[model samples]
Target: MTAEQINDKIELCESAMDLILSEGSFTIAQLSEATGKTASQIYSLFPNKKAITEYYYPSLVIRYSAMIGEIEDFESYTISEKLSNFIFTTFDMMEDRREFVEDTFEKMVFKKGCNSEFHQEMTALFKHFFTTDGRIAVSAGFVMKDYFYEFIAREYLDIVKFWLNDDSDGKERSFALTDKLTGFVEEVVYNKVIDKGFDLAKYLISHAGLAKNIPLFGEWITSWFNDNEEENKDE
Candidate 1:
């Protein structure tokens, strides 16, 4: 495709994502109609629905992050509350379109050998958040390390997945779980590390090493618990 055509198609795909967020779902035919192109044209650009999903996935995040930034600046909001609100509100805003996000998360981020610009962006985003003034107080002797930020980003994906699958208590279970985990980490940082004379940055980096992989481990344990619960029901 010509560069202009490719750009146009990208815009069309973005528009499709917007519609899906607003109206639940849209077919290639619908996208084509909206873009004043033929269905074949849409397919030529995206190849298939999965390609569309992949294209739309990062775009969705970029948009959501912009929206989150707007509400994130109120003095009344605690950092933890701000972060949680961003997560939940973005999820709610996603509505039925979250399947795409979940799919992208699993296939692109979590799966082995699935690394890309997307994964790096996520890691960097977390690192940036943690090193900033609102995050942890930087010291003159402190080195800007990214270890914990990477871990948090990886864990955040797992948390989102947990929230998505949880139908219990209107997904309050997932929300509560995330809040507890965040607070636990915060406490660990403040009392156990900061107040206790540990190197706070280094401690966070160490915690990152342990916590980043815990999501995958947590998944296994959750599965085991679910299986045992089912076995009990059967017996």
Candidate 2:
């Protein structure tokens, strides 16, 4: 959707949130009254309550994306730094609207209320973060990106759930969790470190002839050794 359309939908969500806070969850008639739109018009805007739920995160994601765009050196930031920024920025945005967020998040996402479209959007955004420009050059970038995307999506939801329940002063504990979690992920995903680790493990396993004792990967490792030997012979 175009920028204008996204803004419009976010505005609609904002209005719905106001109604929700005052009168508890929304009905079509309540939405109509809130937006000065008739029942039919409201239907055209939000086919059902779930549509409102669906639009919420994309609005947040779009806003986060825009916020990072204004950072002149965002491209220079490490994955850990970027992620820390993301969690903190998201929490900052949610601070004033914590009640609104809790009301919608529990009903919409926390209770398994998301749909395929929401997952798809989240996947796409995570893909952009992990693979965009020169951000993260994993050894097998394309091959492993979808797995990374899944990790990020799951992690994000888990963090949101943590935030919702956090009672620490200003949610400091949640911020600490973000720092530690993202730092660990950065070490694993940076450049070819993970690939090099796997390579070293394979070599050690083969060198010690220990693949036979390795159970699940024993046969595969034996074949892997044979293939490498054959390739060396051909050279």
The per-prediction CA RMSD against the true structure, in angstroms, equals: 14.8, 6.3
Give each model's clash number.
0, 0
TM-score of each: 0.58, 0.72
lDDT of 1 at 219: 48
Cα lDDT tens digits, model 1, 1-235, are 4657646656876777776767777887687777788877777677786667566544444555556557645435544664566567656755556755654566765663225444466566545444453544323113334656556666766777787788897788988988987776554443434322334323433564533355675445445445644755885
Pairs with backbone N, CA or C atoms under 3 Å apart (clashes), candidate 2: none
Q: Give one digit per residue, the lDDT tens place, for model 2 in 94-194.
A: 77677877766765665552344444566676677667647454354535556667667778778988988999998888988998998987776676765
TM-score of 1: 0.58
Residue clash pairs of candidate 1: none
